[model samples]
Target: MKTIYLVLPCYNEELVIQDSAIKIEDFLRELVDKKIISAESRACFVNDGSNDSTWDLLEHLCETNAFLCAISLAGNRGHQNAMLAGMMMVKDRCDAVITLDADLQHDISVIPEFITQYKKGYEVVYGVRKSRKGEGAFKKVSGDAFYFLMNILGTKIIKNHADYRLMSSKAINALEKYGERNLFLRGIIPSMGFSYTTIEYDEKPRLAGESKYSLRKMIQLAATGITSFSVRPLHFIFFCGMFFFLISIVMLIYALVVFFHNGSIPGWTSTVAPIWLLGGIQLLALGVVGEYIGKIYMEAKHRPRYEIDKVIWK
Candidate 1:
């Protein structure tokens, strides 16, 4: 049998960590007992600098459970970086690692299927949600828009799939080569061009605590994902500039015609509308260009995404 280390990135999960850990530990043990997986399989909970007792609870759980390990970060490093830190810890040692949210929103039942696919020679097993049932209508609408936009923008990310997936040691090693400070795993994993498969499962609602995905974060993620993968956004600005230039030429011709016909200027509305419209478009173009420049600036610095403050295991 092969060993699978489940990597869970946690942040302020005090409300549900114990239950989530218990369920994960129990399921991992069942996999071991049924000879589906090796006894060395462990579930690692990464404490992403939670302000609550999340790390303390993990310490107690690690002390008592042989299958549980904990990684504590120096500060809150967001979900992707925390997950990356955990995968790096076990990539060289474990046969595979399954990363999921600590909130248990990812269905644990499909874990066996992930391992089965891994055994069948698939290097990557992606867990996709069949439907976002029971979710807020705005979340559903925005999520749909986000996925569609990402695909159109050249990032081949799986729809309805977050960071819940299985990666072989080989895949994980390839993943570590990505040294970008802004980590978008969904976009990067597909770019790996490895043999992979996806399993559809229903997403579960959070049983405890609130979600961390705010409107701002969602927009930021979408912008970052698009900017990280493609230069089309920069091209978009260029096209907008050309488009406005042509429009301005036509408008100038029309204004000259009116001026020669009546020896009078255009109406206030006509003059103000273009000023406001063109100004907005110019600012939008500048903002888009600035975002790309910012990404380049950050990448050139080669900063660490997350710092591991401690690693606890028994």
Candidate 2:
């Protein structure tokens, strides 16, 4: 009799919260009735300070459903932070925890498979999307490119995996030890060195509300993942500096020779070319360094990842 917790992070998902709750409740009921999990297994929703009635709906569900629980964050502390808050609270109470978006785009049916994988000794089970049928071509292509770049940078993140996944109690304990303020769960999960497996499923369209992750958010997330886990971008800057430094020396030598042989030229092209190129390279290098510095500054603050403003339980 093992308890399981499904943690859903919500932000302004009023349109989808009720339906998602119903489906998750039904699934948990089936698992409990079939003896796959204890009756204590529950679905916990973390409301990320949604402006709408999302938290209210979650409260109503918690009142009516014995297996439903809800937590409201002090503010909209991003999706990853909210998920971290919920998981941290329930890790001791449950045998395993499954994290998913409130939109229900990730199939809830995959939970049973995630549980099966956990039973098979995999501490972490990733829900990898086999196909992005509802996403636009731009999103699909950009998503692919992001994972490719991360892999090339030595991050080794799972392809087609979002924040939807399962973590056994052992895995959750390992993750809890990582106290970095910038919580990139997907990037950090593989770093735990646990036995892991992937469950593939086709992504479905949102049942009710629009996606909370916009183009800007996606770009920001990619940047955070890169800066948080890999230093290859900084290394690339070093390589670029070395390359241009060699080129500058060659040009300087060639210029000196030309001055001794053919004298000086009238046009400013030669002077300006090196000036602009060197300046551009220097700025790019500084930018990469600044990115790392920014992360360091954030970590120095030692702020809590999330603040729980409220909690509702039966």
Candidate 3:
């Protein structure tokens, strides 16, 4: 029998943790009863420095349930890092790991299909959402745009896939090789060469608690995804520079023609256009360079992505 570990990352999800825990426990029990996985299979929760009773609940769950294991981070390290921390902690103990959120937005029913895909030699199985049932139209549109932009930036991501996915031990082992401080799991996973497949399922409404991802976080995530995977952003600035330089040269020739033909004309428009255009171009170029430099600064710091404040296992 294969041992399957479910790694859930929680950040101030105290309201939904208990329900999430129960649902996952029930799912694992069903899998065991169906002989899909060994009874030794467990659900591991990584508490990402929740200020509430999330850690306490995880500790209690770990104590009461033999299949529960909890790792509490010292401070909030963002969702991707927390997931990475959980995977790193349990990659050695299970045949495969499925990382999911604590809100139960991702359907747990598709997990069996994920395992089936794994058995079929897929090292990675992504849980792709067939539909976003509860999200607003604005969110849906924004999400689609984000994916489109990511693709344009040369980051190949599985469409409609979140963190809810199954990864074989081999895949997890390969992932461990990536040690970048800006760990974007969704982006990074696809970059790791592996035979992978996807299972489509409808994303359900959260049973409890609001989504931890804010609009600002979504924008930040988009930026991280692009900056981490592609140099296209920097190249975009180069293209912009070339375009403006060409326009400036054309304008210069036009100005020279006007100067020779119609002598002594005060043309403020010509003077202001190049000044504003060049200034904007210079600032934009600097901004792009600064983005990469900022990332480098963070990497040079060599700080731990996440710190574990506590652990509970039984």
Which lDDT values do the candidates have, in the order given?
0.89, 0.89, 0.88
TM-score of each: 0.97, 0.95, 0.94
**Candidate 3, 41-98: lDDT as tens digits:** 9999998888999988888777877778999888889889999999989999999999
Candidate 2 residue-wise lDDT, 55-81, digit = tens: 888888999988899999998999889
Of candidates 2 and 1, the better by TM-score: 1
Of candidate 2, the 10-residue stretch with the lowest lDDT total is: 265-274
* Residue-by-residue lDDT tens digits, candidate 1, 126-209: 999988777789988988888887777777988888889999999999988888898788899999998999999888989798
TM-score, prediction 1: 0.97
Model 1: residues with Cα > 4 Å off, grouped in runs: none
Candidate 3 vs. true structure, TM-score: 0.94
In candidate 1, position 95 carries an lDDT of 97
